[model samples]
Target: MQVEVLSCMRHPNMVLLLGACPEYGCLVYEYMANGSLDDCLFRRGKSPALPWQLRFRIAAEIATGLNFLHQAKPKPLVHRDLKPGNILLDRNFVSKISDVGLARLVPPTVADTVTQYRMTSTAGTFCYIDPEYQQTGMLGIKSDVYSLGIMLLQIITAKPPMGLTHQVGRSIEDGTFHEILDPAIEDWPLEHAMHFAKLALQCAEMRKKDRPDLGKVLLPELNKLRDFAEENLPMMMMFGAGFAPRNNNTYSNSAFSSSTFQVSIIFSKQQPYFFSLY
Candidate 1:
């Protein structure tokens, strides 16, 4: 299966194959300097809080990568396990989908036998697993769409899909969408944020047929978000101030004198008032 998948790899958005040691069952890929998006987004203190613009960019990249896989010639790949862990990022933060362990080629057979004959095998992480796939085990391109939606939600909300607060059903039911966004990003453009969130919600819909195709799921919306960000770069910069470096030791030389003067004024006011009362 690994050999077959390795041989099938041809997309530019996918991680390049370095070599595979068949004897050891090891496949080496081009090392992404930033590691997996999962590591950078969820790891405590280790992962930088991604800015809204960057998050939108990452989401767009992931969508493009998935679209290429699903639409590729000869054999369209179904990445059954599309999750943050499988999305690797380079130093520039460009995303490439990796770990095709659960990838299955869409067989050319036209019969419904493929669905009826095959035994159900759950192939993805629980949090990002397509709910339809979970129930029916009928994997298709749409399943990857669902997973990508979950990942998009993760990027926008800055919350792990399975986190206690951001659990799948609860987030939708409570309407506490802000709870999912990363705290590091204090302000996000209202239109962009709401639009992205709506798309994510559409992706996560339980009905398989209702979810948007990859083309519909990401491209148009991402382009709009990109345009919005470009137009409001100044506002984003202002909001990003907390992320900027501040020298903790750079205090004014008059700091102590200022503090003393404030204290003296307070005491002087009280002393005069007390004496007048007496």
Candidate 2:
């Protein structure tokens, strides 16, 4: 299942699946120099903390990846699991969505609209999961949107998602939204951050129907934020200097002596056997 889904994915924001081996249940992906967003966000394993600009870019990149998956041809795919751990960063800090193990392909009958399928059981991490989807067992593209909202909030606040929406909401209502902005970001643009906070809240509305359309609404807004980040490229470069992991060497299929190279293996009864060659 993972292989079939990954084989059809091709986007800069989506991780590239290089090769697969069904017998070994191994998967190889492009080596992410910086590792998962989780590490960077939490400063785990001595990972450098992410700056506001990079965070903005990562949010937009994740949104772009989700948009691609939701608009896939014939049948759209919903990434049932979307969290910082699944978002990997390359040597240059480019964000790419990974771990499609829990992805579900929506049927053609409802792919073109905002419809959902009632799965027998729920899947995904706790805080990032859509409340509605978890409660009703009905999944849709908006389910991923809800998770994206949580991630967006996480990017700005650098806080756990356990009760983030409520905290942000209270802060906004009390005209103290600035307080929740990650203090690590010394120069957080209060105005822009406030706007982003509002948008994140919208995406996390309790009802899935209230969430904004990913491509039409969220993508454009996130792109604007990304552009704003790019406009401040100098600041990002200065702040992020020497933070990226070493060994920035890049690889391509053509660069390899053989057509394939495998790095990791996994055994799972619920997952397809595959390898992502880096």
Candidate 3:
């Protein structure tokens, strides 16, 4: 199942599975130089934490990747688990969604009878899992949206998701977003930063239907923020530089397709972490 899914995926934001060896029971994937976003966000004593611009770009890159997954040619694939640990940053800090091993290709029929599938067991990291999916195992693209919501919050606050959903809820209610933000970025524009925080809060809406679509709502907002970044390039330049999409009114397929490469064998501890309860 894992091999089938990996072979079919082709997106710049998705990890390219180079090869798989049945005899050796291994899969080779393109190497990401900066390691998981987990390290960048949580590593103690690490030099110069990821700055606001890079974090903003990472959010857009991740949304672009999720948009690709949810809008694939044949069927929308759902990354059952989406979290900082599963997100890899390349040499340039471009965020790519890894761990396709636990991915589920939502069947066309599933939507028609989603409620019927409620008996299905639930599985995902505790904090990141969709509340709806947890109570009733009806999985959909919206599940990924909930997870991305938490990830966006983490990117902004440099904090973990555990208890964060509620924390942000209170922050929003009390109008104290500035208090939760990481001190490293305290100097960033307050209104702009709150706009992002507010969007993330929306994505985590308990009802999946209320959460914004990755491609339509979330991605566009991220790009608008990018446009804001472009206007304030000096802010990003203060930190290490990273990717900003080319200025164009159109979106192209090649804009997202991964460059294919070859690999015969692979061995590593950093394979996709697959977990399922059903």
Q: What does candidate 2's lDDT look like per residue over 111-168, in tens digits? A: 5565688899999999999999999998999999999999899989989999999999
Among the numbered candidates, top TM-score falls to 2
Could you give the candidate ranking by TM-score, starting with the highest? Answer: 2, 3, 1
lDDT of 1 by residue, 125-152 (tens): 9988777788877777778888888888
How many steric overlaps are in each model, in order? Answer: 2, 9, 0
Model 2 ranges with Cα > 4 A deviation: 240-278
Q: Write model 3 residue lDDT over 68-182, tens digit each, in one string.
A: 7776545567887899998987767777888766676676466324412342678779899999989878788888899999999998888988888789779878988788887
Worst 10 residues of 1 by lDDT: 269-278
lDDT of model 3, residue 174: 94
Clashes of 2: 9
Please name the candidate that would achieve the greatest lDDT relative to the true structure. Answer: 2
Question: Residue 156 in candidate 3 has what lDDT?
Answer: 83
Error of 3 at 93 (Å): 0.8
